[model samples]
Target: MNKDLADIFGNLVNRIVSFAHLAFDGRIPEGGAPGETELRLAHDLEQRIKALHRHHTALEFRAGAATTRAIWDAANAYQQHTAPWTAIKSDPARAAVITRVGLNLVALCATLGWSIVPNLSERVLGAFGCNNAVPRWPTGPLLPLLNSGAGTPVARLGLPVEKISSEKVAHLTARFGA
Candidate 1:
């Protein structure tokens, strides 16, 4: 079960990262500007992202619930063992619960776009007793990131700047003497 959960979470994170990369670098496939194909692909991507978000949320909730159950079960077992003392410290069980919680937290952080520095720092710093500074989320949609030279994924994938018009092509040729 843990492995399955981890795999699903990992896949979700990968997809989100891919989507973010595509959005930032403007590698969205062209389809005659506002053509039907482009609209359809945009809709499909939106739906896929939403579905991924829901799945990630559900997994996080389930993992948290499971951790709570494990903790409770361990506590009950400890009480039974130390009857009159009313406390039975089960270090092993406690450790297991902590491990499960940690894994779930990591998955949650990775899947919800929280792994990105700007988003992560903005959302999680307060919980970790940090009050130094918060980064702002990107203002526009993710597409601009993919199009900009600064996009990490764009650089990694070696995606070229898309040529959308003859004038732009001519201008580039003139400027760069291609």
Candidate 2:
């Protein structure tokens, strides 16, 4: 919306991207073990991601208020046409208000930047009972999203690929039995 609000959103996005890089690249300080690093990263990422999500929710509330005001302003100008529907299209003043609201929404999205991906990944993992485990990247349709232009920040982080030995895999299967 305003310059101040836009700046705040931009800062939040930058923080999110930085934390995501740490989590996804396995640069997060891990205490020990094979899956240990992944687990810790997932937990740290979840906390930061949730904070960013809360910020986004607050922005949405502000945006909704702006949109409601625009709609009300538009309603006052309704005349020859019907009631509520005509208010949206028939008034020039209302049209300007609507346009401003739309621009604000666009600005908000642009400022948030790369924060959406890892947050989404966390949700997907939760759906599978992974409980904040950082699943391997490129595991599904997410691969394309992570490789697309929209995924530039994600690609830049460069997740590590550890070659699991067959013996270790067998041991894991025997132990965890996944």
Candidate 3:
């Protein structure tokens, strides 16, 4: 409803799109392979995701924007803290773990986001190699991972959005409550 909220959605879409594109694109550095740290991080992230799900469910029942705020905050935090780009080059192995966890995190968010924006969520799911149905929460390490080894290659994944337009920001901010 507001510019800050719009900014959050815009950023979440961008981050998810980037993760999937880079992973299946065969652009990852050779040294990166999913490992122990990844496992730990995945478990922690799963808990966070479940909590988000529960919160979302509760609000819809009691009858809210609560979940949106929580997810956007989580997505932004993960995006900032987990620098998959840097890890891919510096520590490929760690990068693998980092990227996977981050991707899964985004997948979880997208699944939750699907109901609100079916088209966008569908594209997000397809990118993650899913056909239909929201993926079960607390997914495994590789549940939604990009399988570069799968069949023939397709068109390279391009970014849906790079930055929010000033027009969009102004439009969104103006629509917010006075």
Candidate 4:
């Protein structure tokens, strides 16, 4: 696999894992109303998570049939759990369960070679809502590099790169000779 592609996938996996943890921890109690600040935070997190997914898809990485099906199943489960957020707000415990489902989906993605780092889960914690919690996102020229025609895997993808299965890699190799 391209090192640049691998790095991008690893970073995205880290971000997804962190965001999933935050979403899980952001749940309120049953019959409890969330404040404006909480709502804003949730909204920001939601948008960020959506952006992550969009970027991942834009990479167009493909996996084996079973792995792809498993990923889709996990994603579908996460969506099913999170779809009725407003209705389930009255059931806060269920909200936690839903967030946990999201975490499971993220975890599955991370486990299935979507991440280059093998011990990333051990390093990345889901410590959201803590005073010391600070997201350690990449502080580099990722956006500009991706948008530019730099000939890197990310630039070639025309977006960010995500997990590339062996089959996909072979296909891309035959097609692009990269």
What ranges in model 2 sit over 4 Å off? 26-178
Please provide, for model 1 over 1-178, each residue's C-alpha lDDT reduced to its tens digit, 9 standing for 90 to 100.
2333333333333332343343334222221122242234334434444554455467765544344333323323322332311111344333222222222222233233332233433333332233445422233332332122221221121211122478986997899997
What's the best-to-worst order under lDDT? 3, 4, 1, 2
> Least accurate stretch of 10 residues (summed lDDT) in model 3?
146-155
Cα miss at 174, model 3 (Å)?
10
lDDT tens string, model 3, 28-122? 22334555544555555556556666766676622134565566576667667767777667766666655555555555666766656556556
Q: What TM-score would every model get versus the actual structure?
A: 0.23, 0.20, 0.60, 0.31
Model 2 C-alpha lDDT per residue in residues 1-178, reported as the tens digit of each score: 3433333333332333344344324112122122332233334433433444565577765544344333222222211122212333565334232222222222223322223334433432332233434443222222122112321223221221124679997998899987
Give me the overall lDDT of model 2. 0.33
Residue-wise C-alpha lDDT for candidate 4, range 1-178, written one tens digit per residue: 4465345344444433343334443322122333343334344434444455554467634433234334434354434435435435577554444434443333334433323343433232222221222323322332221122211111011112345689998998999997
Weakest ten-residue segment in model 2 by summed lDDT: 76-85
- Candidate with the larger lDDT of 1 and 3: 3
**Which model, 3 or 4, shows the larger TM-score?**
3
Ranking by TM-score: 3, 4, 1, 2
Better of 1 and 4 by lDDT: 4
